[model samples]
Target: MNTTPDSIRHVALSTVRLPLAVPISDAKVFTGRQKPMTEVIFLFAEITTEQGHEGLGFSYSKRAGGPAQYAHAREVAEGLIGHDPSDIAKIYTQLLWAGASVGRSGVATQALAAIDVALHDLKAKRAGLPLAKLLGSHRDSVRTYNTSGGFLNASIEEVKDNATRSLEAGIGGIKIKVGLPDTAEDLRRVAAVREHIGPDVPLMVDANQQWDRTTALRMGRALEEFDLTWIEEPLDAYDVEGHARLTRSLDTPIATGEMLASVAEHERLIDERACDIIQPDCPRVGGITQFTRLLTLADRAGLDLAPHFAMEIHLHLAATYPREPWVEHFDWLDPLFNETLETRDGRMILPERPGLGVTFSDQARAWTTDAVEFGIR
Candidate 1:
């Protein structure tokens, strides 16, 4: 670590709301559990050290709670003003304690995530190395797949068209939303997508925790013929025992954990042998610090890794996984950054640029709904 006092001199936080082209409906929306998600709310943290080094990181929420994350971040970010930006784990603990009243997981950890990630980005930038290189990369590229194109809102034709375009663009796999109320409809959609993409391409489906055990099993069996890569979140996120049972019963690999907010929650899934693949979202699991901890545990259990979102950050983190990993490709976030990630032959190539390999675009600033800052810069 750089011993120079290059203390974090400023922390600028902003809330950017990115609108989807259309209302995104998943199983959650169709099940009446939540309304269609029209936007993704982000808490962006831009941290600067006294030495002039800077880093940018962001966390996001879907449907609601954007304000709460921003408010919580604003409250705790003050503590980072004089701290060495390289002491990521220590600073993460301090922020967690700063907001101890709200407990350690969910929104509290999520809010801290942006700060945690920003610190990592700063440390990597200061070293003049890409974040993946800073973290010890296992590979420069990770298998990539597209999820933004495969939502329940789109019809079979739309889904097929999206898959065709995505493949042409170099995405390696296709994943479509499943678990609509009608099982037959879900099957028909999956069948159509499989037929369109052909069996040679990787295909996966997400249930978004909308299915009961019986339904998940039945669908799991029915979808088996398609030779899916994995079935994601077929049961509730916390249903470790349920997931374990389903995992044991199905030949298809089970993937979950994006909804988990902390390392301990994921520990349950890893300990109990719940799933074959683990999909931890960096921001949602409290940024790279906690996400790395989960990766160690998942690796020991011999589980496959496929980080959920935020390809800008996950691309670096996933590249470091001991085992080859998959990074989800969502073009929705493409406009937020001035640099774009490349996908070819179904893999996301880690950017050679230092830190998270991205700089905020003017559009990101234009979408800012709120902003706050702490300390001098």
Candidate 2:
């Protein structure tokens, strides 16, 4: 399966919209009639070589811009059509400069990320190895923390039920959403979840950057008794000094960086001691090429890795992290892909199949609003 730039022939972009099982409310967005945040936008890319090999990858945004990401991916595809997928760094650099004017963080970087992931998937498949094995695996299984059960829109009873189910199904860590209007209610919910999951299991909370310096410190102190594993994004993503202050003031580890766009930003967080646990989302940080760089940074800084979302992509990358990795668990994506990630003894067992070990489900294809191609004859 030798492929060169000449052998690389076609690029395709598509989109699918999937409704959430239950509408999720975070600190910022509540999904109701006026807000109407029901469905998520999925933008996908498919790369095919002259040898007839294909790789699949996708990216997402919460409520807007499925078409924009798809358009950007299509625009990026023009620069990629004649380039070998094996030349990941070369392609990534080309894409970076291609979108330099747009500031390369939000949609531009996300588009590059989609292409990078598909290239890796294609390379791993050609080699007949899983992506983790291709990257080098530190462990066969990575520990998972369930996030689906803890959105702000869910009731306390719903949260408790979700936590119980996650534990009963063998996952050991549960993270719930905090940062509601009332800090007392937040404390109460955390305490209830902690009690329900028991004394030994790890309980974490995400404030989703909803708090200021003072509120974060107050809530961190109030919920300290519950023995949270970490408090996520208590302050705004860019507030390095505030995160550092909260990290120093609290006994529980401060975990942030899900929203950061670049390694330099993460370096600022690390050098400033902004967080104890560092989380990098692969798609958000321009895919594996950039993600691996961040992993090395976390290793040197002696920080633990807990990647943000899309466990399908993170689970493999997490296996290679220097420290024990905590991969987030969200079932919202289950319907979009064909394969199911297995969780046993609170750990995700990596799939043995080549590449990402996934393809779009029939349901996902049915939801696709559009698909277009470049370089295909």
Candidate 3:
């Protein structure tokens, strides 16, 4: 253990399982690409410096691979025990090589997401500033939208009700899942929701990458009349060329990139001008350091930003974008944190608290399935 005055002294890891209220389905599930999602698994990292300065960060997996992230992180996180706490990027590189044999993307980097995020949180907390301010922010709040209430599993009436509730709750936009096998039914749901929310509200639709080229174009054209803010993931996430074709052929904007796990992959989409809006998931892309690299490219390409989930971590990231941006709102993670995010006037406000401004709730601790620690506390 490091006895140096400013070096890292303690590192702890916990695997927590959060069970969903219901098994949620999207276009991918209906198409048999994957099963419904029943729970979200998190790999949390808490680091303490010798001076008692602390930071908390986490990464998560869905459907499968929870144990892989935990196991991988367990093997490599100890490398941080004696390093300087403020050298975040350097520390991430060290961990990368510590586990180089397993490769650098997917589960490998995803596991490192917790440590990277925690280091940022620790540094920000030490500075006593909100993460956005520490990173340099452009706005105090980002445009907000909701996707949890409008899943494909819900009925048309349920979709309308969810949209109404979300709007009444002060959210500025609504997003609903599309890409059902039955194209007409998808249109019917869009039409009903559009009518319910009215033309003034900004509405987006996600296809979850369930469409082929022909269907994506056809559906994109048909969706134009609804006045959609954008048509999301109409084709596969990897179909940059196809997305470029659709981006040109249709009036509605194309949005994708959430499924991609590395900044290198997003660079291809940005350089090719594949989509109008680029959505990235921070935890999926190896946390804030990697996410910050992506933001620079996205800002240069002038692509609109709307990160995919974990609004707690993304609100700060979105606030730093040079352009106006949006953040997805899902109550799914609310049970895991002690605090609630404020939404009003169609935006999610930045927290004044240091770091990510979140602390794990008792429910989160109760949900911990495994734990490990290194160094003296």
Per-candidate TM-score against the hidden true structure: 0.98, 0.95, 0.98
lDDT order, best first, reads: 3, 1, 2
Give model 1's TM-score versus the native structure. 0.98
Give a tens-digit lDDT track for model 2, residues 44-139.
888998877788877787756667777887776788877767888998999899878887677788877887888889988988999999999999
**Pairwise lDDT winner, candidates 2 and 3:** 3
Candidate 1 residue lDDT tens string, 1-377? 65667888999999999988999999998999999889999999999988899999999998678899999999989999889887898999999998999999989999999988889999899899999999999998999999999999998899999999999999999999998999999999999999999989999999999999999999999999999999999999988999999999999999999998889999999999999999999999899999998989999999999999899999999999999889999999988999999999888888999999999999999999999988997
Model 1 misplaced stretches (Cα beyond 4 Å)? 1-3
The better candidate by TM-score, 2 or 3, is 3
RMSD of each: 1.1, 2.0, 2.0
> How many backbone clashes are present in model 2?
0
Candidate 3 C-alpha error for residue 244, in Å: 1.1
**Candidate 3 lDDT over residue span 1-377, tens digit each:** 43455889999999999999989999999999889999999999999998898999999998688889999999998889988998899999999999899888899999999999999999899889999999999999999999999999899899899999999988999999999999999999999999999999999999999999999999988999999999999888999999999998999998899999999999999999999999999999999999999999999999999999989999999999999999999999998999999999899999999999999899999999999999989
CA lDDT, every model vs. true structure:
0.93, 0.86, 0.93
Off by over 4 Å in 2: 1-6, 30-36
